[model samples]
Target: MENDQQQKLISELVFLIEKGNAHVSMEDAVAGLPANMRTVIPENLPYSIWQLIEHIRIAQKDILDFCVSEDHEKLAWPDDYWTEPVEHIDDQTWENALNEIKQERQRFFDLLQDEKTDLFSPIEWGDGQTILCEAMLIADHNAYHTAEIVVIRRMLGCWR
Candidate 1:
């Protein structure tokens, strides 16, 4: 791809991941959540806001790792990706988790920004996935979970 085309593609991916043009951004979905409610699972819901938050962090990190690392081991389904609700989360820990998500997201953005990273080339490892595929996967996965957080908040009467 030409330099201009690559830069444009990277710009679009960044916006898709960060701007929440089609749904609530992860940050906005969790912002101002009551600490008391973070671990409260709504009726019929399998996970809490806290679990969803952590799941997003874990899954995003996994995909980012896959995109960049040839040695990345595949994570087990359900077990590796999902988390049980905790009894409580301190403010600092919660903030740290959120910051980890932010930092990992920035790392992915940096990968895209690098001129040498080929967005369309297939991975040489187990799959034929390309950086473009991985980028869209991250965006889609985060958006889906972020929407779930919003729905759970609304169910708990906590959403504004």
Candidate 2:
């Protein structure tokens, strides 16, 4: 990535953040979720709703970083560093952190959409693939967890 592209992406991220594009899905997914249940974890379930949000946000951050970085940490075979580790998080802290992450995430996604960078360009974090190649990789992760959050709300009897 050239310094110019990085500069544009950085500015675009700020524009996206100013536009308030994040939280659209999160708000809708948790729309009817009981405020109380936002902190609850189901039996044997290691991931909470807030944890999932944090995880996805981490992926977004790393992906965005790789888009501009010259050196990104290489991941072992079949082990993507883009994914976040899930663990119990304090309810209050999770909620606060999640909101902040959402704000940043919107910027990251918008940066990607606006970059329109070369599909053949190598991803700094990946083995040896273009940024486009890596982007397609994250699409499923976001979609899958978006569905998971939707279902979680339903399971909690909070989905309307």
Candidate 1, superposed: residue stretches over 4 Å from native? none
Candidate 1, residues 1-160, lDDT tens digits: the string is 7888889889999999987687878889988999999999999989999999899999999999888887887899989999877889999989998999999999999998987888888977736898889889989998999999999999999999
| TM-score, one value per model | 0.96, 0.61
Model number with the top lDDT: 1
- For residues 37-83, what per-residue lDDT tens digits would candidate 2 score against the true structure? 75566666655676567666767566666776767554453345223
Model 2 gets an lDDT of 0.59
Worst 10 contiguous positions by lDDT, candidate 2 = 15-24
Instruction: Give the root-mean-square deviation of each candidate in angstroms.
Output: 1.0, 6.6
Would you list the clashing residue pairs of candidate 1? none
Candidate 2 segments exceeding 4 Å error: 1-24, 71-98, 113-116
